[model samples]
Target: MLHRIARATTAAGLMVSLLTSFSARAIASEPPAHCRDIAIPVSIAQGQPARYRVWGQLCTPEHRPAATVQVLVSGLNYSHLYWDFPFRSSQYSYVRQANRAGYGTFNLDRIGIGRSSHPASAEVTLESNAYTIHQVVAALRGGAIAGRAFGTVMLVGHSYGSEIAKLEASAYRDVDALVLTGNAHTVSVSAQQNLAQLGQPVGQVPRLAAEVPPGDNGYATVQDAQRPEFMYNVADADPRVIALDIATKETNTLGELSTIGDADAPGVTALLRLPILIADGADDKLACAPDATDCSSAATLAAAEQPFYPHSPVDAVVIPRAGHAINLHRNAEMAYCTIINWANRALGTPPPSK
Candidate 1:
């Protein structure tokens, strides 16, 4: 999942013990396709039908059908590739770690980004994208994916994805729980700047200008050098990891960006009744505030969320020394472990230690 990168003053971080990963795998079956393609049919509020030939991959510890499944939605400008990062395979991949922990993880590209179909940026608004998420969850529950109906399904999202998941959970009440990462009620000016520098449209980039769609003016990509500045904690992130991100970068549409803040809009109910987790990096400059103020600690961030979810039980954690992309930091495992533990408890599955 892609998260809006925040400025961080210090760094040390993503983790993996090959053994810990192996032990987390509970099912005896071989892992399924590293990734697969599926087209999900969905109709928008306007009754317009469009097919999302989504790119997704699922992994579980056991061979039998998973009792609970986590449908992962990535943030803006990212695709399903965000979940199963190829760089560290074992080290930085949230998907690998989650499978080792025994819960099934299904990672998919959000509608207009990555391998999914792109209808003009105008068609990919927050509400439409939320509808896309709704259909994906329904498909999982109905056994359209991997042909194994899950007894329970949890929705996991990072940054923009988290916002989309929030909308779906609030409006449709279709999910059992939600794990929202790289998200907060507020955003920093630095974060906004990060969004601004994310390159011009496809036609504007030197190499892509000529062949791209006629009016693809709404999508943008991260500039090469700025890639780290936008998505990684430069002080400690692996150089190679940063390189892969820039080379494999995707596009973020203006429509999605303009409506992203609606993640907190009054359009949908604030989740005061659902079980939710608010996860952010201790050094996250963006979610903290415009000047990187506010989220000085995990407790502060959690407390900040209280007003928004007055009646909901909320628990928050801040990954130390990590920036916006906790999963990509050196201590990525800490982020992974925190989430897997929370998810296990929410889904009623045996903890990874068990």
Candidate 2:
């Protein structure tokens, strides 16, 4: 993996554009053949620091330019290039298409996941995560470290990261496009119900921001690795996803819970100010649970309830024979193609269709 750590010596002034330059050569430490690490502090009042991983090639136009910038934000417990990212899904085709179209691709793993800095006590709440993303945007836009400016950056987020993407799109004016995957309307599982489902005592489930041991509450153990197929079937169809999977653990239970309830409700799914695409697996447990029901239903509910943000155009779809990670499963390339097509049209650079 290739990575470089950068600290903001001066405050990233909001109005004045303070640009920092980082040449590709400066990124001396190559991220794993597939991963890179980046750190930038949050601008939030006393908010903890934020860090993320970058993946894929950042080839320039003369090389393989598709879209201007395509960023993939992984769900909790997953880091950049963590899994074997075999390009099996339609999503892969979309990435290739984006590259062909002139877009540089990147993915940022939120704090507490991946190689990013974990707060002294991991603060995995949605609000904090949203704040971290805000800092990331500021750093990226202000040229804090990598100093790369995206002409047309598209945000692709899955599971919990989808909520973060929504927050970023609604709160920041910088993002041009948005994609949300594995969305649930309201967690079908209430606090009590969630405990029962997890077979834990009531009130034992940690808060949205609490940190638990890798095996404390919501984790899949090494012993459970025997069924890698069942645990991560969605990643199997793609070598890239598999590679990514190998680098991550299922120890983000608190992070997932934090995305639910009043703690998670404040800023998540607020309003969309830009074009948005939402995709989900037909049978994702998070979307098809007792309260949520299914992926399509959850998408519709989220869109309908947040009617105030109607100015942003929206499209939703459900993938077949897939679970939570639609982009890593069967027909992965189709998923990517669909999203890229939507993004292209939104960015005013529609691809030539056959």
Off by over 4 Å in 2: 1-67, 82-97, 145-147, 190-247, 253-256, 259-270, 288-308, 352-354
Output candidate 1 Cα RMSD: 5.8
- Give all candidates' CA lDDT scores: 0.69, 0.49
lDDT of 1 by residue, 286-310 (tens): 7755465366655566666656765
Candidate 2 has its poorest 10 consecutive residues by lDDT at 1-10
- The top-ranked prediction according to TM-score is 1
TM-score of each candidate? 0.85, 0.65
